[model samples]
Structures are given as structure tokens and as C-alpha cells.
Target: MESKQTIEAVLQGKIALVTGGTKGIGKAIVKRLEQAGATVIVTARNQPNEPDATYSFIAADLSRAEEVNKVANAIHEQFGRIDILINNMGANTFPGGGFNTLTDEHWNQALQVNLLSSVRLDKALLPKMLEQKSGVIIHISSTSGQFPIWESTMAYSVAKSALNTYSKALATEVASKGVRVVTVSPGLNKTEAMTTFLEDYAQQAHITVEEMTSKLFERVGGVPIGRMAEPEETAELVYFLVSPAASYITGANLIIDGGNFPVVK
Candidate 1:
């Protein structure tokens, strides 16, 4: 059995909303926040299993401005104030070729889902945060946001760059008003969907899936940790950022790519 005391540290009294919280890293965040004593409201197109007592599920299409606003309005009406916001919703598809083959539609799709979704949610919710003079916003970005890959998923990388910049600027604009905003940029992760992507790549490359995975890892110069990150590992950083323990951290993009994006910190 888990100890009650361990469950009390990361979120004792925070009220949190995590977009895309139904699966993968977002789902892990919902669980971790619940353990720390937060009333976690998770928004996605679908609902996850109901096992955690403090968790609430809201189904909505975050990619649409109207839908994003509806979700925000619901939270504002119910809670009147939000203590934390996690912008975790994003969408992208594996590209068959490099940037030359990426169409205008693909670029627009990336921007709409990955960039504008965060913008809309923040716009709808930040006023309350400003009025309260305290809150935290976490942007779940990607390593591609900065050190982008040129051949595959290039448009998604470009969109994420906009997101990273937007997050930094928003953090500065609101920090004086007592709101903290930060970004978490993860490298390639071994989520369920990513695993499926690997299998597809293996078939396309005419090699064993395991061989394809190894070659892909090699192309990226090998993850120093020798593996892709578990969703919970990324969520743990998020748990701290929204907590009082990380009150001083704002406007910074923290990368967790197993030493894949070598930055000096």
C-alpha cells in the first residue's frame, strides 16, 4: 500500500487543469497531481478509466477555439479560480519525406493543434489567474521545438518553436502579475502511440521493428539513459513546477531528452 504522507507533498491544495490528460504523459500527470492532493480536472476528446477519487474528466475538442473556450468557461464557473494549467494537448503525424514534401495543409494542421490550442486556452483562463495574483502554467512542448529534425515531422517542429516562444513571452507578461509559466520539452518518448509509429516505420523500411528502433536511436545519437522516457518521469517535473516548491521557476524551457538535446542548462 502507498503511504498517505507520500501522497500529500506534490499537490496538497492546488486546483489543476490538464489538457490531453486522458492518455500518455497527460494521464500520468493527472494521477500524480491527484496523489499530491489536487482536485485535477482532465480535458480530452475522451475520458479515461475512473479510478482516482479526486480526478474529474471533461471531454472536449481542444483543437477548436470554441471548444477550448467552453472547457475554460466551465472550469471558471465551477472553481472561480484555477491554481494550475497544463497545456498538454498536441497532434502530429509521421512524415513520409522531408520538408520539401510537407504541404501547406500539414503546416496549418500543426499550427492549429499544437500552437493555437495553447493560445486559446491561456487567453480564456489567464484573467482569473491575474486577478488572483498567483498561478502556474506549464506548456508540454517537444525537443523538436528547438533542435528540429529536418526530414520527418518538420512542420510539427516549426509549430512547437512558436509555442516555446509564446510560452516565454507569456511568462514574462504575467510574472509581474504573480503567474508563473514554464515549458517542458521532452525528446522521443516511448508512449503507446510512438510504439505503433515504430512498428509502421519498420514495415516501411523493410527491416525488423527492433532493428528500425535501434537505427532510429543511433541517428539521434543515442539516449544517454539508454531508453525513451516513461510518461511518469515527465509528469514528475510537471508536478514540481506547479507546486510551491518550484515557485521561483518561470519562463524557462526544461528539456528531458536523456541528454539528446545537449544544452548547457
Candidate 2:
């Protein structure tokens, strides 16, 4: 058995970059990687509510190509190379009400945030990883990529599906070069954003938050675990994937959905 200190130092001297790491799942991931002794660099549109001095922070809205380049270049200049890349930035801010409610702008924004941002960042940073012949990249996708709720998550789901495919293709291309790429499709996470969304909807519906949560479960064909996942739990999985323990795993979409996905992939 490994001592806690030894386990915590597993990633000592490693450099990790996590996007949209200011809050929620992304924030949790930053903490996890830092705890494991990795020097973590975080990028997001805004500063974290509770900032930590241990890791460096860069502010950038990754949807824009220039911003993506800036982040990549900054990391290269500061760290020279990254040992782990966690593409944890994503959102489903489009309007609900199925296809007709969505427009070209909405679709484009969805793709830009959920898919293209990672593509651009990967393109910028992957050369260093490949040149070094060692690295891990984790794409934080959503279970909606596989199980879409047409009425509400149409555009968001489409974007995540594209990300899923892209992650697999990138993994296959880079695995032989000693780099591992993996996609993590998390189910419903009890993040602050999710809580706010539920509260707003519940208020509008004149229903309790608990009732709205139950409705969400039913709409998604039920989460057998009977609850949403905590951000820390999902972060732990991301940590494991980037660690040496999961060296043989690549080109795989690992779902941490608490049994919410209806189909067996």
C-alpha cells in the first residue's frame, strides 16, 4: 500500500493545464490535480470566487481563436510543456424548446464553446506533448452527447457528440506517439450553475426544487443511483485517467453518469 504522502506526490514535477477551471467541475479538477502534486495552470473567462495561490491563473474566453492561441502560447512560454491537459470548459446556455428555437448563432456558440475550443487548444499544445512523447489529454464531455433530451438539449447535445467523436479520433492519432487522449462524459453534476438553473426553473413552475430534480431524472430516463454526481467525484476520475494507472486507456469515452445513460455503449 502506498502512503498518503507518496500518493499525493505522484504527479510531482508535472505541469497540468485545465480550461474553465474557475468553478464547479473544472474548479474541482484543479484542486484534485494540485492535491496530487501537479503544478496546475487554470484558464477561464473570469476569476475564481475563492482563488488559490498554489496554481497560476489565466483569463481568456476560449471561444475566440485568438484567445485560444493566447492561452496556448502563454503556457508554452511559461511552462515550456504540459504533462496533462484537461479540456474541462463547456456549457449548454442555449434556449430550450427543441430545434426550431435554436438558430445559427446558437448552434455556432454551442459548437464553439463545447467543441472548437478544445480543438483549437489541442492543436496549439499537442505539438509539445508529441515532441516530448508523453502526455495526457482529457476532454470533459457530457452524457447528453449519447443521450439527448430533444426538447431541451438539442444544440448542446449535438456539440457534445461532435466532441466525443473528435476526442476518439485525436486519441487514435496520438496514442502511438506516447500521448493518451480520453473523453470523460459526466452525467448531471450538482454544480452551482446546475443549482441556479434548477432554482430558476422550479420558481417558474411553482414547484419545489426537489420536485424539479425528480422531474429531471425522469426526463433523462432515470438515474439509477438516484442523485446527481458531485464535482469532486468527477474530478477524482479525471485525476485517475491522467495518472499512470490509466496509461493503457486511450481513445475511450468514459461515462461517470451514475447510471443515467439509458443505452449500453
TM-score of each: 0.93, 0.97
TM-score of candidate 2 on Cα atoms, chains taken together: 0.97
As for candidate 2, its clashing pairs are: none
lDDT of 2 by residue, 208-234 (tens): 999999889889889889889999999
Ten-residue segment with the worst summed lDDT in candidate 2?
A: 46-55
Off by over 4 Å in 2: none
Tens-place lDDT per residue, model 1, 58-132, is 789888888998998899888887889999998668475787787788788889889999999999988988998
lDDT of 2: 0.93
